[model samples]
Target chain A: MTALLSLAIDITLLSVILAMLLCMIRLLLGPTAQDRVLALDTLWMCAMLLALALGLRFASIIYFEAAMLIALTGFVSTVALTKFLMRGEVIE
Target chain B: MTPELDTLPVWVSLPVTLLLLLGSAIVLIGALGLVKLPHFFQRIHGPAITITLGTGAILVASMIYFSALQSRLVIHEVLITAFIMLTAPVVAMLIMRTAVYRDLRARERGKTPPAVKDGEASEVYPFSTKKSLSAKK
Candidate 1:
């Protein structure tokens, strides 16, 4: 049972890492600022999920806290980036 | 490195494993779509898949795994799930609106022709007809 659980977590971790790599490619090659921002947002989300998978693997609460922090930061950064893209500045 | 998994029955472990795999696979597919799609608006649809169903699956897996392992309620994952659900669409909307705004401005300056065809323009942009006709004049 433990082996199965470990296998599942490992697979999830690997898949998310691959997803992040794909997002990175888009981030670098994206032709427009909006595409780049979209890639960044996806990258952060992958990071958050990666943190959660690690938490599951290690069976630790600390990773959960880290995941929450990532989520919060990801939202804020996405909002700020989009705002900048929209108005050419973040704040009025 | 072993933890409480040894004690879990097949019923519990099986579902958790399936959920994790399914969720990650969806996320990967979404990311792939984002990279492979031809346009920004089409690409926007990609991550929506991940944020809604992918995140939900993973969070539910985490919640079930922790709750089962600790023999107690572990619902904190819900917080992150809720936050993501509420915020992702807003971010997507902001980015999309910004893209449309930029494209429209470019059209007004005669930098590029209207992106959408006449038949599709009305559905996508209500003012597209007026803008395109005015720009042509």
Candidate 2:
């Protein structure tokens, strides 16, 4: 809410977005499937952090819930992808 | 003007700003490592820092900010911290295991794995080499 906190939040937001772009580069340029999956996992984390920074900037709690959702779904999807890689299918 | 400096005392904002900057800087560094590291194993290590330290700092900042502003505990961010702590290593382990297995399978089939060579189980490709790392011939 103070000026310094506000500026820090803005910086956090921009850096998070940059992190996501770096993840995208890995996602596209990854030499292997696991690399892509790893990139996606990091991407999800950046998004959640972005959401957190946004919530702080706006002084709202709703963004935290959205971050929680992203974290939950991202965990599931990454596990599923890894499973598929390991056994060629998500379920037997 | 709508009071540009609305009411977070320096006591709270100082720590929050420091933590926010720390979190974002670490996040950026981790992502940079992910992109810059040439090998899959090294790349896998990059986001470990992000998942752990970077996210932890940000969540702690959030907790402090919200709790201070609302004058209550407001600690639900801890749930996210716990979930990530429990799950991130598992995900990383699974991915690394899968990569190792795939490489072993390729070796068994007498084909060249992209990031390994010489049929030596321990011989993962080093990042300093200029050889192709693509999953192709």
Candidate 3:
């Protein structure tokens, strides 16, 4: 049973990697900067997902902690960039 | 039902396996939407699909599988799911607002409307100032 579950995890991880690749294409070829930002946001989410999936596959808490940190940083950076674009200044 | 059921634990594993497959497929579809959507505001909705359903399903599967394997609550997957749900939409909203602002500024400067915002419903760019954009007499 454990082996089967590991197999399932492997398959899902592969799919997640494929999804991230698709997001990368959008980041590369998006027609507008806004579209690119959208892609980058999605890319970060995918990376977080990938990390969580890794944690499950390996049964490792460390990967989950790393995923949390990545999610936190990604959220802050994306928000800052958007706010900067809105006001023409990142800092008041 | 005794020997097979005891050996396989089919009841528990069945739903977990299906959920894992389904969640991965949904995430892939969301990524497709992100790639294929025509514009920024439209694409902003794509990852939300992953956050709401995709991440939720996978986390649930993780909870079930990990608890079965480890013989404990194994609820840590909830944290990642919650984080994704809380963050994805906020980022999407901000990106949409920024796109709208950029489009308005470009138009005010006499540039052609950026392709993404051309036919979309417009939002007033709140950053506009009367004197800042006007020429001195």
Candidate 4:
């Protein structure tokens, strides 16, 4: 059972990492500012998932805290970035 | 590393494993769509899969694994899941609106239409013809 669980966790970790890499490629290769912003948003989500998977693997609450933090920060950043893209300034 | 799983029986472990795999696969498919889809609007749909179903699956799996292992409720994962669910669509909407705003501005400036398909072009920019006609004057 431990072996099976470990295998599942490892596969999830690998797949999420691959997804992050793909998001990075889109971020780099995106033709428009909106595309780049979308890629960044997806990138942050991938990071959150990666942190969650790590938390599961280690069976630690610290990783959960980190995942929560990532989620909070990622949402704020994406919102700010999208606002900037929309109005050319974030505060307005 | 293995201590957590040692407590879980095959029944519990099997579902957790399947959930994890299914969630990751959905996330990967979403990311793949983001990369392969041509238009920015089309690409926007990709990550919806991750935000809704993928994140839900993984969070549920985590909740189940920890709750089963510790022999108690471990519902904190719900916070992350709820936060994600609340925020993802907002972000997608904001980014999409920004894209539309930019595209309209570009069209107003008489820039050539992007390589969007004909059917989608009309739907995506309803006033495109009128704008182009006005710009020509």
lDDT of 4 by residue, B1-137 (tens): 66556878988899999999999999999999999987787789999998889989999999998888888999999999889888877888899888877777776677744635445656655665566557757
* Model 4, TM vs. native: 0.92
A45: Cα error in model 1, Å: 0.7
Quote model 3's TM-score: 0.82
lDDT of each: 0.85, 0.87, 0.75, 0.87
lDDT of 3 by residue, A67-91 (tens): 8888888899899888877897889
- Pick by lDDT: 1 or 4, better one: 4
lDDT of 3 at A25: 95
**Candidates 1 and 3 compared by lDDT, better number:** 1
- Model 4: residues with Cα > 4 Å off, grouped in runs: B113-126, B129-137
For every candidate in turn, the CA RMSD to the true structure comes to 3.5, 5.6, 5.4, 3.0
TM-score of chain B of each: 0.81, 0.81, 0.74, 0.84
TM-score for candidate 2, residues paired by index: 0.89
Task: Report the lDDT tens digits of candidate 3 across residue range B50-128.
Answer: 7688878887887776676666788887777777778877887788778766776776777645553455434432344
Per-residue lDDT of A7-80 in model 4, one digit per residue for the tens? 99999999999999999999998888888999998889889899999988888767899889999999999999
TM-score for each model: 0.89, 0.89, 0.82, 0.92
lDDT of 1 by residue, B10-125 (tens): 77788899999899999999999999977677788888988888888889999988888888899999899889988987888888987787777666676553334335444555
